[model samples]
Target: MTVYITNAKRTPVGVKDGIFSTIEAAHLAAPVIKTLADCSAVPPDEVILGNVTGPGGNIARLSALLAGLPQSVPGFTVDRQCSSGLEAIRLGAALVASGEAQHVIAGGCESSSTSLRPEKAVFSPQSIGDPEMGIAAEWLAEREEISRKDQDDYAVLSYRRFAESIAAARFTHEIVPVGGCSVDEAALKKRPIERMAPRAKSAFQPGGTVTALNASAFNDAACAVFMTSVEAPGMKVIASAASGADPNFPAASPVPAIEKLLMKTGLSVSDIDVWEINEAFAVKIIYTARKLGIPFEKINPDGGGLALGHPYGASGAMLVLRLFYGMQQRNERFGIAAVGSAGGIGVAMLFERV
Candidate 1:
């Protein structure tokens, strides 16, 4: 059995303590989940959501109830750090393939502005000290010989791409309006990219290449996709895989994860039409693309996390949502969505345009 996404939607990424600050994590997801089912015209049998910073409990269950899903609809939460959203989707697909479910809603949600800070030390076994995401990216940039200038340039380009899209109202189709906040708050939409990109202060270490500007903003957002074993119109998942690595260098995890999928499917890098690698940091995409021998032009044509924000769990799902629209717009065929998680984990899935 093949699982197919029949509908997908995401809240505009909001800045911490910004548009979505007053909303709780589950509440943030209610509208998206509800609309996903509404648009799919197929009620979900289960709801699976990925969350990292929300208050403890089954956020998926709460969100499902809040979305007005049937009382019999059971839901659960998955915590895989940055890969949580995509992990949820993988789980949902397995359920469909294993005869566990006919229809499922799976994605992620995060209200970082109101959620408690996550315990970084617990992310990995104590050998490697817990380093902040920005710090890890800086280390990777230095290790890979990616320059401050390159990272900054990439960040600016991401913002520019998003800005162009916003001007054309390109995201109107996928974004769910909430709190009257339709505009993406994290992208420097009001500012010129050239002026703001170079002036951002280094946030993690002194003299570090990763700056507050180049790194993804910690954000609040939610995303949901309705998937079923029945085929869909535009896209269908073809392959999926996950891998784990040394927790200290989490940024490098996506390479093995993507390779694992390709290896499983007997496909090569050249077979993919579009690559959606989450820009957790500019270095994340930069290193992963170079390692995979993929051209920059083929990656993130509409911008990524850096331009908008990293709403933690929501990012992975957002990547797939972006790829869905990108491939549709380009008349493309095969695409991949991949993300590196905090515990040195990687998740990647290959999708073909139907």
Candidate 2:
């Protein structure tokens, strides 16, 4: 069976304590889900969502109900930390592939400003060194020899690309207005990254290259895609893979995951026309691109988490949402969306324009 992404929608990303601060995760996701379902004109058999910081319940079900979905449409939430969103999509595609469901609504939602958060989620045993995310980025930067200037320059490029995309109105169609805010809050706030990146102080460790400007900020957003086993006008879900690396090197996890995905699909890096890897930190993109030998220009063509903000659970699905529209813009053939998460886990999904 083949699964196709027929429609998708996402709320404009808001920084932590920003526009979405007052909204709950379920409420934040409901509008996007309703928009997708209504646009596709297909009642989803199931609703799946990825969320990391929700208030401990079936957020997917809550969001589905809030969207006025029929009670027969059951829902569930997946939690894989940062990869939850992509994992949700992968599971939806699986349902279609297995003939268990013809149509499904799947995506991710996050409300960092409102959700309950633990200081640390215990990714690994103490002996294994469960470092925080920022520390992980610091380690990856030091190991990869990614200098402060390199990360700073990359960050500047991200902001610039994002700004350019906004000017071109590339994100206009993908966003669904929420709370009277139609645009991504961060996009409206211009930053002089080039002027401040070099002068920015280390955020994680002494002499570390990781800084606030080079790292993605906590955010609130929701994005979902409509998938169906029926033939449709969109991209076909090809395959997906998940892998793990050492917890201490979480930022490098996407490499092995992408490798496994390509191996499973029997495709080469050169065969992929576009790549969408979550930029939780500039080093994540810098390191993964180098390891995969993928050109920087081919990755995150519309910018990434660094410039758009990383709403943890929502970020992975946001990657697919961006990829779906981006491939349309470029008329690209094959693309992939991948994310490396907290517990050294990584997920990658391949898509082919249809």
Candidate 3:
């Protein structure tokens, strides 16, 4: 059986304490869910959402209810840190392909400004080293011998690409207006990236290459896609893979996951037309591209988390959403979305235009 993603949407990415600070994660997700459900014109049998810093409890259920779905339509939430959203979409594809459901809604949401900030959750055993995300990215860059200038250059490119996309209005249709903010907050707040990126001081370690300008910020947003077993004009789910790596180098997790996915599908790097590898850190893209021999231009052509802000769980789904629209615009045949989580875990999915 084949599963098709018929529709997808996301709320505007909001910077920390920016336009969406007062909104909750579920609420941010609700509008997007409602849009997808309404557009599909088919009540989803299940709704699954990936969330990182929600207000506890079942946020997927809350968001589903808030979207005015019938109580019979059950919902659940999953957490794999950064990869939560992609995992949810992968599960939705499984449900449709397995004949367990006719239609499903899956994605992720994050409200970093409003969500509780408890003590950090344990990602790996202490012996394995569970460094904070920034520290881990810093270490990964250092280990990969990535230079400060290279990371900063990548960061500048991300900002430039994002700004250019906004100017071209490429993202207009994919965004669902919420919180009275139609534009992504980070897009508006972007400083003179070219000038600041070079002078930005190290954010994690003294003299460390990783800096605030080159790393993604905590953001609030939500994204989801409608999946169905029935054939349609949309991207078809080809395959998915989940893999793990050293906890201390969580940013590099996507490398193994994408490798596993390619191995599973028996496809090579050149076969993929577009790549949506999460840009939590510039090093993530640098390392993955270098390892996989993928061209830099093919990855996140609309910019990535570095410029748009990373809304944790939702950022993963954002990758799919971008791929869906991007492939359509460019008339591409194959695309892939890959995300690395905080716990040395990664998820990658392949999609082909149907």
Which scores higher on lDDT, 1 or 3? 3
Error of 1 at 80 (Å): 0.1
Candidate 2, superposed: residue stretches over 4 Å from native? none
Residue-level lDDT tens digits of model 2 in 1-354: 999998888999999899988999999999999998888666999999999999989999999999998889999999999999999999999999999999999999999999777567889998998999999899888888998888988899889889999999999999989999999998889788899899889998988899999998989999999999989888899999999999999999999999999999899999999999999999999999899899999999898888999998999999899888999989999999999999899999999998
Put down candidate 1 lDDT per residue, 161-273, tens digits, no spaces. Answer: 87877777778899988888776885534867688778877888888888877888879999988888887776787889999876767899999999999999999999899
Give per-residue CA lDDT, model 3, range 1-354, as digits (tens).
889998999999998888998999999999999999889767999999999988899999999999999999999999999999999999988998999999999999999989787568899999989999889998988898999998999999999999999999999998899978899997787489999998999998899999998999889999999999989997999999999999999999998999999999999999999999898999889989998999999999999999999999898899999989999998999999999998899999999987
User: Which pairs clash (backbone N, Cα, C closer than 3 Å) in model 2?
Assistant: none
Looking at candidate 2, what is the lDDT of residue 343?
A: 84
In angstroms, how far off is 34's CA in candidate 2? Answer: 0.5
* lDDT over C-alpha atoms for residue 340 of model 3: 95
